[model samples]
Target: MNDLHQKELLLKSILENTRAQTQAIEDDELELLETLITRREGIIRQVDKLDQEMARTTPGTSKEPTGPIKELLRQIITIDDANQELMEKSVQDMGKEVEAVKEELRTIRERRRQGESYVPEYGDYREEGVFFDTRE
Candidate 1:
């Protein structure tokens, strides 16, 4: 088989394995992202090989690849781009969640500034010592 065909086959196989990995994700989204990146790297390697063979075999044949191979490569590029955007958004969302929790804690502290307080499990909160007289 020609190098171009071989590279295409390898890329297809990698894509299939990647899809399987993605489908296996239940709760850990990072696993899917990691597998996507790995698949992208494999696609890049395969495309590089295909490009080299095409250049060596048929010099000055159209720079743009045609047919199914071209479509598959385009899809791979799009997926990688999308994955990067999603990863960035996920991090930003997590930062926002943390900030929201901090805001809530700050509000609670401000409201309870004058009452008997207990130290937080995760941090220090000043305790107000007010002795109660129980003699009637």
Candidate 2:
């Protein structure tokens, strides 16, 4: 197989994995997402290895990507951008939740502090104990 064709196949595989990753993200399938990302990484490593071999064989030659490869890369980059945006939104939502929890805790502490500030009437304890008998 031609090296370019091999690279194309690898890139297509990466792109397919990337699409699956997007679906995993949307569905909140964390385990599947992790697996997809790992697979993509392995595919990417293969692509890099292929490129290195090609470079070694064709020294000093500019190996600009052909049209279809360029298009695949473009799509991959665009989807990756969307994925980044989704993750950022998730982070922001979680941040808001954390702040709300902190606020609730602060309110509870303040209410508790106020409730603790009251002193019981001194007369209340007097009934529980007998004064020295004034009358025989």
Candidate 3:
């Protein structure tokens, strides 16, 4: 009876540990997502600034003349477009990571549901004891 109690306690401890680790990983992932969103927002603001600058510097075919500001504006626009594309790809990758994590969580839940019995779920382990190759 004591052995059974100890086994149960051990399983409970393992489950608790797993839950804690999962929670920590989830928190970290959330923080990373927030950071990504913040970065995207910053990029958007930069794009808006570029737009305003361009509008001020090149409203029409001004009789005066375009300066280095026009060239700089063009370069800024290119940079903004590239940054936007890169951020979009990063977001897509993050989404894939989220899905992978979710799948891992699902698998962990299933394994937990199966219980921590020493008996193997396949092969001749049900009757042949440890001599059986459970992997088969």
Candidate with the greatest TM-score versus the true structure: 2
Q: Model 2: per-residue lDDT, tens digit, 30-127? A: 89989999899999999999999999988886688878989999999999899888878867888999999999999999998887678564534645
Name the lDDT of candidate 1: 0.68
Q: Candidate 1 vs candidate 2: which has greater lDDT?
A: 2
Off by over 4 Å in 2: 28-32, 58-61, 118-136
Error of 2 at 67 (Å): 2.9
Worst 10 residues of 2 by lDDT: 119-128
Worst window of 10 by summed lDDT in candidate 3: 2-11
How well is each residue in 16-80 modelled by candidate 3, as lDDT tens digits? 43344334344555565455445545545654564555567667734331454444445545654
Clashes of each: 0, 0, 0
The per-prediction CA RMSD against the true structure, in angstroms, equals: 8.5, 3.6, 25.4
- Tens digits of per-residue lDDT for model 1, 59-130: 988777677677767765665465456557667888999999999999898878745355566576677899
Residue 117, candidate 1: Cα error in Å is 8.1
Point out where model 3 deviates above 4 Å.
1-65, 116-136
Model 3, CA-based lDDT? 0.53
lDDT of 3 at 43: 48
